[model samples]
Target chain A: MTAIQISVFLENKSGRLAEVTHALAKGGINIRALSLAETIDYGVLRLIVDKPKEAKTALAEAGFTVTETEVIAVAMPDRPGGLAGIVDLVTRHGLNIEYLYAFVGQRGENAVVIFRVDNAEEAITALQEGGAHVLSAAELSAI
Target chain B: MHETTPCWNREMEFMEEGHLRPLQSERLRDVVARVYERVPYYKEKLDAAGVSPEDIRGIEDIVRLPFTSKDDLRDTYPFGLFAVPMEQVVRVHASSGTTGRPTVVGYTRRDVQMWAEVMARTFAAGGTHIGDVVQNSYGYGLFTGGLGAHYGAELIGASVVPTSGGQTKRQVQILQDFGSTVLCCTPSYALVIGETGREMGVDFAGLPLRVGFFGAEPWSQSMRQEIEASLHVDALDIYGLSEMIGPGVSFECLEKGGLHINEDHFFPEVINPKTGDPVPDGELGELVFTSLTKEALPVLRYRSRDLTRIVTEPCGCGRSLRRMERVTGRTDEMLIVRGVNVFPSQVEEVLMRIEETTPNYLLVLDRKPRGMDEMEVQVEVSERTFSDEMSKLETLSERIGGEIEETLGLRVSVRLVEPRSLERSTGKAKRVMDRRDLGR
Candidate 1:
């Protein structure tokens, strides 16, 4: 129904993203997906990792400002119109998606998509009712 | 006065030590009695010290009097320490204080006259005279510097150009077009204008700008040489605080060695900063002053906190008043940037208002290439305020910069460093990194 996401504060400078990767590498955690949103002053490194709690600790101990939030992760058929179908279903359900990122993993011909929506419970209910395989925190980690 | 010496008040400037001591003693005793009788703050301080006006028979009994610190001024606030009634006070000036409030000083008509007289000496000590066009560049409004030098220049029958501060190119143009013979501003600002004139292809050596009075912040002897060469004029140092009637406290004469204190009005003493006891002549200690002739806001044995030595030797200028070595440093952590007082705690106060910022901060201070003060405050981003958004962080930095400017009256660029990026030592963390070389 919901997945854990780790967010880190990064100054918009060289080696900042490298530092985040370095921290995760040192902590022996795998970053499943990440989206970098930036401005002139600083950036926010949104990370979906195999172990969110450990990644947060590693980044925090490495002198990074880190936060943990809940997100919606779903799997769809790996086809041309798969993303369009799921997005249209959510839009028809009147659910707002704040941001979304995707990772290509062929788990029986399906792609994983992580979403940050306004209401995670409602988004999960609507997606499940629409026959979408909504992934849980455990299922996202297992992937 | 001797023909070799040029002084504003011939009688007082050349008065022998024997005559000046008694005059100071009489004035000190009178002011002590008047403050005790009129000001409640002084009355409480004197009574708490178990000393009264009768105990202060002359200048010799000044030690028995309690010392007034800036904290005492803060406690009394805006006008609680004024000795005279508001009806008799003619002017007021203020300087930024450590706390949110500013230190205010009020002056009576006669007190204003005394400030002008001492400032006149400050001008004449450097050989400025009538018919000289004095370009007064000190800030004019609430600060005493601009108006203090203005009144003195006019009192000496000299034409004044109240240029105030800023606009370096315009200042250079005025120096060229107005034919100003005397210059007044901070040492750093003088360097700024000198460099601007050079860049604008204005030759300073060809101009008639003879001398400049620089103060409001400390500069090194090397800086004096730099300014003299750049501006092509004899640069002298003028010292004062708003509480002491601004810029005429003590001044460097043509000798350009130590500054001569106008002891007739302000009595100067050097004391061990920790013990508050008087330091011997020629030994460095904190400089303290007692206002002898001031009426509106008379202060006795006010701790100045400036570190310098007292030299009682007769100067080649033939002035008998004791001179102080140029101030070496301060006993406190106050930073004087572009003639304004900036405290690290002041910045901390501003940063604390924003919940996202931690209490730990570092202030990096430097001088621009053209010679204006610049600062950057490095603050750590907190975990609670972290978000998956960039505009929120940008807004945080801008809000910090705005609040700091409003509080300290200084334009400081805010730098949001990463958490744990700023050093945390086992002992006291160093909060300030002063990069400007004032020969320190």
Candidate 2:
């Protein structure tokens, strides 16, 4: 249940976020979900786009430093404490969440949360056995 | 009052203007004859210009000679420009040749002695005296700065530290423990030391640094002010090139008005860069020099390409040697962006004034897809100013861009890089990267 995520290295300056988004839009790639981790000097922009390879190429060609990382997307009910339930399941299985962000399904039926963990395979299996719905790469991209 | 002045050679430094002109005229005549007779390159150029040693009767006629450029030196390669035979040459030094083939310079035994004499004069002009401790931090070997200063300090009987750049922490400790009174290095390296000392909790101002001889790169007045205040020392500018005889061509005395050229050894002339005609004193132009007494490498009417004015007014320090204003920029290094001239040093002046940015920066020039020139200035934000807040970072970039536009009269995109992202140099720092052809 692992998915591909595109991360870009960006200097903490004005119009940088817009530059990346504009490039993706011009490339006709849709960013389904995104999160940004930043420090004083630079930021890490993580993106879940429709076409990961194409988005990476477009951003790289536009002079952005980009990287590909594998993450797992967990599906949950679109209700209160939905993310908390997934976190509890991972914690009970002794799996740590490196980082996570959530987005509503395109159909608005369920909430899909993307997570980065130390061991993607173990997290996927544990979450699956814990009654969590883990979406495949195709399913995550479709949503 | 004259007895108290620390002039290495009072005769040359305080020569009367009337005597100075005759001395320069005699040396100029002798050097021109030597080059025309010994070096084929000078001979052919002089012959092609339809001029001979007989035609140059005085220093005034030096304008009639052909100008020698760095490209000429490069074309001749190693030892081609040497007037003396290889067996008579005693020393050799070369330019870094970051762009292409290195230009080599040779020195005879007398040339070495002359170099030592000028460097000693430079040291004394900066108020360094015997029994003082000197820390020579300019890079050693091939590069002329380190060994040039080393010999000069030794000639003056000062105790030399011989710490040849790098090792910032250790350099600070040595500065304090050794009681170094004289510092010699590029000004940027001096700033690096000051910043590193402050980070290490060392009070650089509390140290015994009385004077600094900084050169080998173009710097600004604001940088000098910052360095002087931070190190609590009188920061002086020294000018020279490897093509010339190292770091003793000229130096700032206590008057700090302008750098006094050792005109008795190196003749100075300011010429319009395009027209090749001498510009009147007090006006900006390209600086050209002719080695009056150099034995091995007697360059006749060598174009220095440095932009500055000649100051004939006698210095308050009692030196009659004509001084040249601080070099503003170089013709080769000036970038024409959208028909506006921009010098990296001007950008550096702006960056040094901003408290949030470090002096370390890179200028990238490229051609946009639409055939317009695009200039990007990559500056490293100080560790304290590096913030995750996009608004603060954007404000800093905007402020830098605005300052550059105001100063250089050209709009440039400012890219704020991480601290230490740009490469630091022990020798001359590479500041510009032209990628206009990469678009092709």
Clashing residue pairs in all predictions, respectively, total 0, 1
Cα deviation of B210, candidate 2, in Å:
1.5
Looking at candidate 1 chain A, the ten consecutive residues that score lowest on lDDT are A101-110
CAPRI quality band, candidate 2: incorrect
Rate residue B413 of model 1 by lDDT: 89
Best by TM-score: 2
Scoring only the A-chain of each prediction against the true A-chain gives TM-scores of 0.95, 0.96
Q: Pick the candidate with the highest DockQ.
A: 1
Residue B41 shift from truth in candidate 2, angstroms: 1.7
Deviation from truth (RMSD, Å), model 2: 13.0
Candidate 1 TM-score over all chains jointly: 0.59
What value does the lDDT take at residue B409 in candidate 1? 88
lDDT by residue for model 1 (B266-374), tens = 9988887777889889876789999988988999888988878898677888888889988755768677888766767667657657889876789999988888888
lDDT by residue (B1-440, candidate 2, tens digit) is: 47677789999999988999988899988988999899999999999999999998888998998999998999899889998889999889988899899999999898888898999999998888888999999999999999999999899989999999999899999999999999999999999999998999988767888999999997777778989988889999999976679899999997888899999999999987777889999876789988899999988778898988998677788888899989967867777789887777678769878988888899999897899999999998775545433456678889999999998889999887856668874445788999988535
